[model samples]
Target: MRNLARPLLFAFIALIISVILSIAVGSVDISPKDMLSVIWNTLQGIEGSTQLASTYQTILLTLRLPRTILMIMTGAALAGSGCAYQGLFRNPLADPYLIGAASGAGLGAILSLSIQWPASSFSYLFVPMTAFIGALLTVFIVFQLAKVGTTLPVTNLILAGVAVSSFATALTSLLLVNASGELRRALVWLLGGSTMAGWKPVISQLPYALIGLIGLSVLAYKLNVLQFGDEQAVQLGINVNRTRTMIVIFATLSTAAAVAFTGVIGFVGLIVPHILRRITGGDMRRLLPFSMIGGALFLLLADIIARVLIAPQELPVGIITSLCGAPFFLFILRRSKGKDW
Candidate 1:
């Protein structure tokens, strides 16, 4: 407990700072003072009485707030799921997209974009819904391919994921080639941009994120036991197959929900959990929650850089993550050589 306290404090403070920065550092910069003032006023039911300009209030409330919230939720979801995946596979390199979730989601999003649905309130839901469905289906297929009789081998699961991910990526590229008017939009989304604005995304993603995060957290002890290998875990009275399946389902739910909205943001799960695992050790109970906080902090900072890096010309947040994550991935790969992670 003592060992966990300092990191927890640091993560909490960093998360708070990131949230404030995310909300305050957007296009029309709002000072932390004014941002807090407006929030306080709103919470106190005296929003109109605040001295802040209406434009500032509108921007803070209607735009940045929801965006920040969604980003936090998305970050938490991805990181938590990533940690679960790493534990489930007993491999430090595993990530939220391990089972073709991102590729499948991308394919689904492209399909929706190809249709070019008319701009309407309900239309925003189509892309996310379809992307989530695609992710679930893709996972189901991977599981089927990987299953040998009643048991699932981790090696086969990973191989199937890689193969299916390739197929899905090819399909996505094919669709992109034929997608006339929506080409640029589809590309931006594939590269990890939040297309929908305002609060709808937050509302839609909340349940899945909560359920997945909670479910993973609850299963942390089981994940720790599974690290002992499937045969030993089974001898210890753990239902290895059932536990693995539940972990996959929960991790996929969280990952799919996030990708459905934020596009294919890579390396978040890989980066956050791996970093937290180093600090907190391999204890899933500690690693999982801290990864959630660290993920929010990391992504909010990434989104901030995406907003300000080019000033006025915003890059996709996924681009920022990849730029940072790709090198980190290489470093992890090199470090993992000749050692058991």
Candidate 2:
């Protein structure tokens, strides 16, 4: 308990600091004092500000706040799901994107984006609904492919993910090629980002994120037991298949919601849980919470860099994560190469 408290406390502080820095260090450069003032004023319903105050307030309310909140939620969801997947498969390399959830969501989001919806109400729900359906379906397909009678092997599951991911990627490319007017926007979104940040996305993602987080946390102990293998877990009174299904469902929900709203941000799940596991140990109970906070802080920092690294010209957050994550993933692979698959 003491050991867990320290990391949790540290993660909380880091997340708060990252949020403040993210708000303060954007293109227009609002100071921390001003950022806090704007938040307070907005919360207290204090309207009207000086010209300078109004400019900062508008940027804060209209842009940075929603962006940061979505960033935090997206980060937590990806990292939490990643942590759950790793525990479920007992594999260090498992992640939502690597396993086809992101690819599936990407395909759905693009399809949604491509369609011209006449009703404004339908427009709001269309992309997220399709993305969630796409993600769930892809994961289901992977699970079916990976199953061998009663037992599901992790290696087979991974291979299935690779095949499915390739197929999804090809389809996405075909769709992008045929997309005329929406080509640029679809390409940018496929590359992954949160530039579309707004209250709408925040509201859209909140419920799914909460549901995934709560569901995963509840199943953490079962995940820990399943790490001992299916036969042993069953002997110990755990229903391995049922737990795995629940974990997959909740994890996919979180991952799909995130990509549906913010595009597909990667390496978050891959990076956050692995690093935290080393520092905090393999206990999912402690690890999941830390991963959530660590993911939030790490991605928020990445988003901040995406915003200010090139000044006015913003880079996609996915590109930044790939730059950092790709190398790290390679290193992990190389180090773990000789061990059992």
Candidate 3:
């Protein structure tokens, strides 16, 4: 009962408050009551052709709403991947990028920006698709290199991810070095950006995040068992290798898709899981769900700070999180004595 009670309650409440807060606080001041009424009416079509106020509707439909939904999706995707990566490698310091998603995605974006490629310039949505393709390709290449017969060699997997990440960074830098003015746009994006979340990117991410989250949730029990070390898990009758592979694949897809939309929003994934671990211990069943909620609220609040910190000019949400996370990380480093590198 104690195990189930607190984490579940916190998860539910955090989601509710974050959603409301995300909608209410944005570039334009939106009172909660009016915003709720606007959402209800638009969703229910209570106004029909009468229409909501043009400014209100624009902010609600276009800016605030898309940003909020994107935040939720990105949060789930990162947090989910973070959980999988930490569990997969049995390393507390592990993050979603360990799979090569960020590296490949950065390469793709750098290419697009170098060529002065606007997403609209391509009929097939080249930038995001390119990022997705790069990410999937990295995953493919890593798996091919790391897999031995029917199972993955864990040591090899980690090494492959590191090698891929290093290669991607080198490639990204090389691209940026020779890039013309157009390609330079991607350079900022490579670091990460908060360019307004569009409907296409948001819709594209919805299915991937939902599928990955649902799949991970169903595998939560196996993941929990797998965390007890591979040898022990095998002794307990868990299909250790297969379960690990499934979770790794699941994490890869979610992180890649979300990164395609929101360029490299860091720390939400890494921070949420660690904080949740402190609160709930390292139980995957509790860990995964609570991580999702923590990710959501963390980003939602980060988004709010991003919007307001610079006033009319918004700081990228990733920047805000990094600014906050960097200091906390250093504090952690100091406290860790000789444990962390």
The prediction achieving the highest TM-score against the true structure is: 2
Indicate the TM-score of model 3: 0.83
Instruction: Please list the C-alpha lDDT of all candidates, in the order they appear.
Output: 0.83, 0.84, 0.73
Residue-level lDDT tens digits of model 1 in 117-142: 66755555676677767887898898
Q: How many clashes (backbone atoms < 3 Å, residues ≥3 apart in a chain or on different chains) does model 1 have? A: 0
Candidate 3's error at 146, in angstroms?
6.7
Report per-prediction Cα RMSD to one decimal: 2.4, 2.0, 3.8
Where does candidate 3 stray beyond 4 Å? 44-52, 108-130, 140-160, 173-185, 332-341
Residues 1-341, model 3: lDDT tens digits? 34568667777887788777777776678787778677777888765234445567667787777878888778877887788788777776677676576677666655654564455646225555566567768877887888888666667877888899789879888887787564444455555555635576677667767777878888888888887788899999998867877786677667766776677787877777876776767778778877887787778888888877887777778888888877886676577664521
Candidate with best lDDT: 2
TM-score of each: 0.91, 0.94, 0.83
Better of 1 and 2 by lDDT: 2
Better of 2 and 3 by lDDT: 2
| Model 2, residue pairs in steric clash | none
Model 2, span 206-295: residue lDDT tens: 888889899999988888888889899999999777888899989988888778877878899988898788777777888898899888
Alpha-carbon RMSD, candidate 3? 3.8
- Which model is ahead, 1 or 3, in terms of TM-score? 1
Error of 1 at 86 (Å): 1.0
